[model samples]
Structure formats: structure tokens, C-alpha cells
Target: MKRLPGHGLRRGQAVTVTVDGEPTAAYLGESVAVALMAHGDLSTRATKGGENRGLFCGMGVCFDCVAVVDGVPGTRACVTWVRDGMVIERQDGPGARRAAPGG
Candidate 1:
């Protein structure tokens, strides 16, 4: 998932976010979905039957791109902005429970 030519030249400050415990490069103000896609990781979560789901209806009309962010589950990756040191993990299914604070 290569970025459009010249599109990378006008991005916000560079930042690093941890995705699935792996350090992934991202930019401030960029949505987590964009960052994930740019890193060649399209699937954000899976269905109960194990079907992978990713970016869809980029305007947030859909909830197919949900993932756990910074210990919070079911976050819409398409709208959540990336921040330095942000922790992101690909969710497994729709039954994910909210992570306990500081846990």
C-alpha cells in the first residue's frame, strides 16, 4: 500500500506507533487506518467466524475497521489519529472486552 506520489511530502511530523507490539512508522494527524495500510497491514480485525475486516467506508459509516488502541478495544481506526508511542493491536473478534485501566 504505497502512498500517492508527492503525498508524503506534505505530511505532519513523523511519529512512531506500536502496532501489534511492533514499532510502526506513522505521522501525527494521520488516521490509524492510513498508517496501518501504509505499513502493508490492511486487516484491522476479524469476525467471529475468523473473517478479516479492514478499512471500509472511510467516512466511519462502517465499523469494520475496529481495533484495540492503547488498551481500548473496539476503536475505529479510520478516525483515530495517530500519536507518538500509541499502542495498536489487531483485534480478534467482536467479543473483545474493554481493557481495564492501567492493566
Candidate 2:
């Protein structure tokens, strides 16, 4: 795992969070939502009616935790990691959408 240099997090303030199934280098300096949104992943999940969902609330009070981050299901996108190899995908529901052939 690659470490990202930041000063806001104290020696005992930093914590590592994984997104999807990939390892992410993140700090506890900011909200988990902001960190994940910064990854350029505009769409975190597809609604039941097939609508795209993004960061609406910066707080962890929302139900946007429908994603699977690090094998944990229902993880909130707005409250997650910010780094490389964070395996994010448009969550279909409790289960994941099967990838298209050769995708």
C-alpha cells in the first residue's frame, strides 16, 4: 500500500480504509465521502429504476452506503477511501451486477 502525505491527520489520527476490494491510501483528516468522490467516480450506484447516484450528502447519515468496498457490502460512497486501486462500481442493489462478457 502506498502512503499519501498529508498534515491534517495527527500521528494517531490516520486510519486506512479500503474501497471495493482494492487497497486505498487514505487519512482520517476529512469526511469519507469527499475522499471517495475525489476519485473521479461520478456514479457510485444505479438506482432500482436505473438512475445514477453520486455524493448528495457529505455526512454519513445518508443511505448511500450501498456499495461494496473491501468485500463489505452496503458501504457508503460518501464515507469511504481516496486513493489508487479502489475497486468501485455502480452498485445494482444488495448484490452486484454481473460484468458483461469480456468487459
Candidate 3:
């Protein structure tokens, strides 16, 4: 999804987050999903058969945006905030719960 224009928006402090080891620009208080999407990372996790899924429903209700952050599995990117130096990884198979470093 395209980022909305900055009009009528108030962003927080500047911060840098790492997605799959790649440094990405972000802002404090922004959701990890937003941070990932802002950096062109739309896929967050893989389901059965290696089908990737991403931010769906946006809110915490849908778990499609779940990923790995700071070594924690099943972290809902849409609800988790991004912090400076935060490390995010794309989740592999949900059953395996393995995290891989890449887009």
C-alpha cells in the first residue's frame, strides 16, 4: 500500500529500524507493519506452501501481519511499535516458526 501524504500528520521522533538486517528509516510510535511497508516490505510471514502474507485488516484483530522482532516470534507488526535499532525478521512457516533475514 502507498504511504499517505504527510498532510495533517504529526510524526514522532526519527528512528531507524532493521528489517531482515536491512536498515530502514522510521519514526517513533509507528507500528512495525507501517515501518516495514514504508520500506517496501509488504510480506511479513509465510503460510503453508510458502505463500506469504502481510498486513491485513491493519488492526490487531487479524494476525496476518505477524512477524519476528528481536527474536520474538508471532509479533504482530501492525500492533508492535518500532524503535531505534529494532530488528525485524520475516517469519518462515508458521508451524516451524523460523525467522529469516531478508525481504
Candidate 4:
């Protein structure tokens, strides 16, 4: 989806977050999904059938926006607020796993 200029309400302090190793601009109070979608990133994970999925409910009810954030797996981007220096990665599937800490 193409986002228009001056979309949504005014945002808070601007910050940088990494999505799949690429830095993107984000706001402090907005959800990670919102920030990513603003950058034209609609897919956050792939289904078991290899189908891409993204935000659905925009609320925490739906798990479609799940992604690996800050080294943690199964994080819902819709409810998780963006933080500076956050590292988010797209999930391969619903059961995607992250590498062992310090491994």
C-alpha cells in the first residue's frame, strides 16, 4: 500500500529502528507494524504455505503481524511500540525460532 504524506495523526520524537537489518524511521509511541507499514513494508512473516502475511486486526487480537523483535521471537508488532535501536526481523512462519542467546 502506498502511504500518503502527512498520514495519520502527528507522531512523537523520531527515532531509527532496524527492520531486517535495514534502518528505517519510526516514532516513539507508534507500533512497530505502523512504522514498518509507513515504509511500505507490509509483510512481516510467511505462512506455512509460503504465503506472506502482515497486519490484520491492527490490534493485539490477531497474530498476523508477528515478528522477531530485539532477539525475541513471537512478538506482535501491532501492540509493541517502537524503540530506538530496536532490531526487528521478519519471521519465516508461525513457529519461527530465534538463535539461542550467545550461541
Candidate 5:
């Protein structure tokens, strides 16, 4: 769902966040899922079978929107707010691991 301008909804200042090694625009106070979805990134994670998954429930009850954030795995994007320079990546599987430094 694209946010149309002139809606009169107050939004925080725009900032950039990195997703899958690419920079995307996001706003303060919005959830990480929102930031990713707004930038046309519908898939937040992938299952072991390589099936893409996206936001199912806006709330954190559902685990469909789990992603790796800031080198941590299994983070729920729906409840995590977007921060400037935040790094986010889709989880490839249940055993996704953070890359080693300088590798």
C-alpha cells in the first residue's frame, strides 16, 4: 500500500536504512516492516524451502515478518521500529548466521 501525499497524516523525518545491502528510505517511528514494505520490499523472510514470506499480521503475534536486524537473527520486523543506518536482511532459513567480519 503506497502512502499518498496530502493525506494530512503526520510522519517523522525521512531517513535511510540498509536492506539486503541496498539503501532504502524510511521514516522515524515506523516499524521495520513498514519501512521495507513502503520501499516495495514485500518479502521479509524466506523459509527453508525457499518460499518467500511477508507481513501477515501487522501485530507481533505472527512470526511471518521475521528478519535479521543489526546482525541478530529472528527479529520481528512488525514490532521493531526503523532507525537511521539500521541494517536489515531477509532470513534465508531457520539457521541463518551473521557474516564474519572482514569476510
Candidate 6:
């Protein structure tokens, strides 16, 4: 497969992002981290203890690869390719963050 070229996405590159119900388009060849960051969604997942986490390690070494993409859990945005009409959501935390309160 061929790469889309880094960050070169224009209005017609064929990518979309929906964060917390809001939608936005993304350029091809751009990392999911870069796309979300562009829309101010730096914290792709919430930590178990209520801490915000995103792309700390650009490499695929971090469990921080927990991004909800198109209804799937634990998708690595930093390495995943941007597709058309993709929906992204921040993981609550390591333990789902909801039971902890104030998350």
C-alpha cells in the first residue's frame, strides 16, 4: 500500500473525525494523533486516576495506544491511518474511569 504523504491532507483528501459528537475532516498520510491534536483533542484517553493522556511516546511502545476509533477500543492513533468518516473518543482511563468519579 502507498502512504498518503505526511500532513499533506487538503479538503479533498477523504478523511473525517468525530470527537464527542463533533465532526471534522482530516488529511491523508497524517497520524491520528496529529489529526486529533489539530482539533484540540490532545488527551485521547483519560488515565485511571483521572489524568489526561495522549501521544506521549510517538512510537508504539506505550499502552497509551487506547483511542476509540470508529467504535473500536484500544486503537493506536499515532500509528493508525486516517479513514473517511471515522469517529474518535477518549478512553475514560485504564479502568474505564467512570467508576472513579470526577473523571
Tell me the TM-score of each prediction against the true structure.
0.82, 0.52, 0.82, 0.80, 0.83, 0.73
Best by TM-score: 5
Candidate 2 lands at a TM-score of 0.52
Cα lDDT tens digits for candidate 5, 1-103: 5678888888898989988777999999999999778767698888888888889988999889998999888899999999999998878787484233375
Instruction: Give the higher-TM-score candidate: 1 or 6.
Output: 1
Candidate 5 wrong stretches, greater than 4 Å:
1-7, 95-103
Residue-by-residue lDDT tens digits, candidate 6, 1-103: 2558896745547577776567877777777787778777687787667777889788767868577777777788799877777777767765341222243
| Model 3: per-residue Cα lDDT over 49-71, one tens digit each | 78889999888898988888988
Score each candidate by Cα lDDT.
0.83, 0.55, 0.83, 0.82, 0.84, 0.71
RMSD of every prediction: 5.0, 6.1, 3.5, 5.0, 3.9, 6.1
Best by lDDT: 5
For every model in order, what is the number of clashing pairs?
A: 0, 6, 0, 0, 0, 1
Candidate 1: residue pairs that collide: none
User: How would you encode candidate 2's per-residue C-alpha lDDT over 1-103 as one tens digit per residue?
Assistant: 3457874645334445554443445554454455455545566666777776766765667776456554555777665644443454446666574243366
What tens-digit string does per-residue lDDT give for candidate 4 at 23-90? 99898999989876877769887787878889999998989999889988789989999999998887
Error of 1 at 61 (Å): 1.5
Q: Name the weakest run of 10 consecutive residues (lDDT summed) in model 2.
A: 11-20
| Span of 10 residues, lowest total lDDT, candidate 1 | 94-103
